[model samples]
Target: MNALYNCISKYYPITSEAWKALSNALTQIKIPRNSFLVKEGTVCNNLYFLERGCLRGYYSLDGKEITYWFGFEDNFVTSFYSFISRKPAVENIQALEDSTLWSISYEALHLLFDAHHDLERLVRIINEQYYIRLEERFMAMQFKTAKERYEQLIENSPHILHRISLGQTASYLGISQETLSRIRSQV
Candidate 1:
């Protein structure tokens, strides 16, 4: 939980009371590789913070899986639309490696938000940051070349290369593994 503490503290300080409340709400669990955190068409009822390993968010298109984002250690991962709207998820999140995660149920989170202004602020900030990232990714997908997208992802998330499979990485880049190999060779 040190990772969670450090990450949240880096963003904003919380009172000891707030910290205790959050920790009390967090449940630690281990997820094995190849497991789904949230599957398409299911409602996402929990928000998880990865304490170790990697998770990928993807959705199937015409039976092909296309990855949209990855969550690394100390970062949050969730099917946002499903979690926020209480609707079925359009995306799926899976563990890329065996992982330790801290999770809070939707009810628990709302309770915290209602009880603590600091917690509410934290949630707001997290939401804003996630939205910004989503917009950036959407823009890149619409405007950037495949090679450019690959380069930008490598620049921003160098460690991801070592954490995920080549096929998964290619999927995230929206390219064929062969194309990723060609791009990698050129680099």
Candidate 2:
């Protein structure tokens, strides 16, 4: 949990009391590769901190899985829309590797926010960061060519190719596996 503490400290320092409360709320769980952390049509009840390994968020469309985002170690993982709106999620979150994560239920998190202003502020900042990344991705998809997108992905997150299957990577880029292979060879 040192990793979680370190990450929280980077965002905002909490009182010992708040830390105690948060620690009590966190439950550690391990998910094997290809396991679903969250499935479509379910309400996401917990927010997870990826302590080790990777996860991907995707949606099923026209019988294809379109990956939208990835969560790596030290990142928070959740279906934001479902978690916030109390609605069923349209996206599925799956473990890309054998993973360990610290999870806190929505109720527990809201209780903490009510009790600790610092914790609330920290979460607000984290959400803001998430929104910024989402906007960046939206803009890229709207404006960039597939080649340009692939190049940007290589420049920004080259390690992703090593961590996930090419097919998944291609899906995330909104391209076919064959097209990704062609772009990769040209690059």
Candidate 3:
């Protein structure tokens, strides 16, 4: 769990006492590739920290999976809407590779917040970062063409291509695999 501690320390430092509380709340688990972490129509009860491997968040739309985002090592993975609102999620989070994760239930997190205000602030900051990325993605989708998006993805996260299938990458870019192939060939 040193990796988790290092990641958390980069965001906010917690006292040993607070760390102990958090450690007690976290449950480490392994998810096989293609396993569902958060399924559609289910309430996401836990927030997970990806200790190793990758995951994707997607929606099943008219028989097609529309991937929205991906999470890699060190990423916090969850259905944010469902986790925060306590509502059923419209999207699913699936492991793209065999993954190891540490998770904390919503109830446990809130209890930690009550006992340790620093932990709350740390999560708030992390949520703000997530919101910023969400806004960036929204703006990119609004203004960029598919090719531009593909190019940006290549420039920003080229490692993703190596980790996930091309079809999944195409879905994340809001394009067909054929279209992605064409763009990729031209590049």
Model 1 alpha-carbon drift over 4 Å, by segment: none
lDDT of each: 0.92, 0.94, 0.94
Cα misplacement distance, residue 33 of candidate 2 (Å):
0.8
Instruction: Please give, for residues 1-187, the per-residue lDDT of candidate 3 as tens digits.
Output: 8999999999889889999999999999999999999999999999999999999999999998999999999998899999999999999999988999999999999999999999999899899999999999998889999989989998999999899899999988888999999999988
Better of 1 and 3 by lDDT: 3
Q: How many residue-pair clashes does candidate 1 contain?
A: 0
Q: Estimated TM-score per prediction?
A: 0.97, 0.97, 0.97
Give model 1 RMSD, 1 decimal.
1.0
Ranking by TM-score: 3, 2, 1
Decoy 1 TM-score against native:
0.97
Clashes (backbone N, CA, C under 3 Å), per candidate, total: 0, 0, 0
**lDDT by residue for model 2 over 1-187, one digit each (tens)?**
9999999898788898889989999999999999999999999999999999999999999998999999999998899999999999999999999999999999999999999888888889889989999999999999999999999999999889899999999998989999999999999
